[model samples]
Target: MAEQRRRLDPAARRLEIIETAERLLARDGETVRVEDVVAAAGAAKGTFYHYFPTWDDLLDALRTRTFEHFDARYQLPTEVDGPIDWMRVLDELAAAFVGFTLGQERLHDVLFHSDFARRRPLPADQNATIRLAAVIRAGQEAGVFAGLDPEPTARLLFAVLHETADAVAEGEDCERSLAALQVVLRRALAARPEEGSAQ
Candidate 1:
C-alpha cells in the first residue's frame, strides 16, 4: 500500500480542509456540507471552526477555491515546444477554455452567479501575463506584430476569449461564436508595417 501523507501545522490543515471541500463541491454538486468536508479531511470540527467561523466563511473559502482552480485546472499543453504562431496559440487556447468551461459548467455557475468571482482577487501567477508575453514575443519575432503593448494586448485577448464562454453558456450558436472570434483574433494580431501602404 502507498504511504499516507500527513500535514503537521494548523494552517496547512485548514487549507487541506478547504481544498478537500472544494473536491466535494466539484464531485457532489450542491449537496456537499461542512460536516462532509471535515469528515473527509479527517479534521475536527474545532479545526474547521477555527478556519471558518460560519457558513459564510465556508462560502468564502469556496470562492477562493474556484478562483485558484480555473487558473491551474486547464493550463495550456506543456509539450508544445518551438514557439508557435500567436493566432494559432490563441486558437488552441480558445478551444481549451471553451472545453474547460463546458466541463465545469455546473460549478462555474455557482461561482459566477453566486458572486464568488468577487471573493478572491486575481493572483499574480494566474494573471495570464506570462502567456500573453509569450504570444507577443512570438508575434514580434515573426514580424506579424509591432508597435503593440504586449501587456494590454494580453488583457484584450482575455476579454475576447471570455466571449466564447458567454456564447456557449447562453445556448447561442457556439460554433459560430468560435469562428467569429477566430477571425477577430486573426485581424487583431495581424502584421502592421511601419510604412503605410495604399488601401
Candidate 2:
C-alpha cells in the first residue's frame, strides 16, 4: 500500500492537492497555508510546488475549479419538446446562482471576491454567460424572446445574477433577490408587441 501510494499519477496527485486545499480552505478560510495543504494531501512541499508554482497559482486553480462546478450545476437543457420557456430557464439560473452562493458563502467569497479572482480573465466559453447566451439564442430563434443580440443580453443577465449573488452573500434575502432578478430578466427578454408584428 505504501509503495502504491508512492506511485500515484502526477495529474491525480495534483488533483489531490487541490481537493485537499479546498477542504482546508472551507475549514480555515483564507488562513489555510501551503503547509496545511501539503500535510492534508499527504504531499511534500516540493510536490505541491511541482503542481502549483506559487500560492496565487493554487488559488487561481481553485477559483477556476469552483466556478466550473458552479456553472455545471445550472446548465440549461439542450433539447426541448417545443418552444422553450426562456423566462423559466432564467428563473432557474437565478435561483441556482443564489443557492450556490448562499450555500458556499465562504468559498464563494474567497473565489469571487479575492483579488486574484478579479484579475483573472474569465473566458466567455468557460463562464456562465456562454450557457445563458445559448439559451437566449434559442429563444430568439424560436420567436419566444426579444431579438436582441444573445451575447450582450446574456452578459446583462449574468451581471444581474452576479450582483444578486453578491447581495445574497452579504445577508440579503435570497428569494426576494431572485424574484427581483427574474422580474428584470422577464421584462428585458420579453418579445415586444412591435417585434412580434414585425416577425
Candidate 3:
C-alpha cells in the first residue's frame, strides 16, 4: 500500500512541488532549497526530492510549467463576435502577458533581469510563437488579415509583449502596461487591405 500511495501522490506532489517552487523562486530570484519547498507544501523533504532531486531540476520544472501555462493561454479566444481580429489577438496576448508577469511577482523581476532571459532569447516561447504564427498565417490565407511577412510580424509582436511584461514585472502599473501593450501591438499588426483604400 505504501508504494500505491506514493503513486497516488506522485502526480499531485510533483505539480505541487513545482508550483510551490515557482512561487518561491519568483521571489527575488534567489536560490530555493528542497527544505523550503517541503516546509511550504507541508510535505516531507523526500517528497520534493522525489520530484526534483537537484536545484536545477526545480528550475527546469518551473520554466516548463510557466511555458505550459503561457501556451495554454496563448490560443484562447476572446468574446468578439467576428472571426479572429487583430484587436482580439492583441488583447488576448496582452492579457496572457500581464497574467504571467503579474501573477508571478516573485519571479518576474529576476527572470527578466537575470541571464536566463538574455541567455535564451528564443526560449520555449518560440513554441507558442510558432503556434500563434500558424494561426495568423491561416488568417492571412483565409483573407481575413492582409498579406504580410508572418514570421517577422509574429516576432515583433512577441517582442512588444515581452517588453510589456518586463515593465509590469518591474513593478510598474501592470494593468496599464498591459493596456498600453495591447494598443501598441494592435496598431503594429492591424491588417491593411490588399486593394488600395479609397479616399
Candidate 4:
C-alpha cells in the first residue's frame, strides 16, 4: 500500500503552488501550463485554480512577488537624519537593480519581457518606478537633483533601466552596460550649480 501524504495548510499550499510554478517556469520558459504546475505542486487542478484564477494571474503574482523580493533587498534607508547622499543612494540602487537582473535573468524576463507583461499594466505601488520616483523626490528636496517633475523623470529612468537590463540579460556585458547607463542617468538628472551639485 502507498503511504498517505499529509495535508498542507491553505497558506502553505498556496505558496507551494507558486514556488512550484516558478520552478516549472524557469525550467520550461513561458510554455509551462497550469496542469504542469498542478502536477509539480502535487495539488489538484481545483486547488491551483482556488489560489490563482488563471495562468496569467499566477504569472502576475509571481512577477509581483519577484519585485517585492528585490525591493526588500535594496530598499532605501529611511532612518537618516542628516543630509542625504543622493548620488551614493542612486549608485547603490542602480547597482542593485543591475545585479538582480543579471542574477535572475529568467525571472526578470518573465516579469518584464513576457507576453503577459505586454498585456497587463503593472501595479504602481509594487513597481520600481514608484520607488525610484520617491528617491528622485527626495533628491529634489535635498537640492541634489534637477528641478524636473519626479514622476516623468522616474518613468524615463525606469524605461532606460529596463532596456539596459534586457540587454544584459540577453548576453551583453553587465558591467559595461551598467556603467553606460549610470552615466546617462547622472547626465540626465544632474542638478546645476544653482540647484546644488550632487557632490
Top-lDDT structure, candidate number: 4
lDDT of each: 0.68, 0.79, 0.67, 0.81
Residues 1-199 of candidate 3 have per-residue lDDT tens digits of 4455356557887887777777778774666667787777777787777777766566666766777777766765543665656556657766776676678776755445555556545355545567657656766765655566788777777777777777766778977887787677665655676345674
Per-residue C-alpha lDDT of model 2 across residues 1-199, encoded as one tens digit per residue = 5577569999889999999988877666777889999987778899999899998899888878877887677666665576567778767877887777667646666666676667775566666788788888877776778988888888888888889988877788877888888899888888887874745
Give the deviation of candidate 3 from the true structure as CA RMSD.
4.7
Cα deviation at 36, candidate 2, in Å, is: 2.6
Worst 10 contiguous positions by lDDT, candidate 1? 1-10
Between candidates 3 and 4, name the one with more favorable TM-score.
4
Global fold similarity of model 1 (TM-score): 0.62
TM-score to native of every candidate shown: 0.62, 0.79, 0.70, 0.85
RMSD, every candidate, angstroms: 5.5, 3.4, 4.7, 3.3
Off by over 4 Å in 3: 1-8, 42-46, 71-74, 77-82, 109-126, 174-176, 194-199
Taking the candidates one at a time, how many backbone clashes does each contain?
0, 0, 3, 0
Candidate 4 lDDT, 1-199, residue by residue in tens: 1122236778888898999988777767777888888877778899889989988889888888888788778877764676768888888898788787766646566767788888887887777788899999888788888988898899999888878877887789988998898898888888888664555
- Write the number of the candidate with greater lDDT, choosing between 1 and 4: 4
lDDT of 1 by residue, 128-159 (tens): 55566676766777676664677888788777
Runs in model 2 with CA error above 4 Å? 1-9, 27-29, 80-82, 196-199
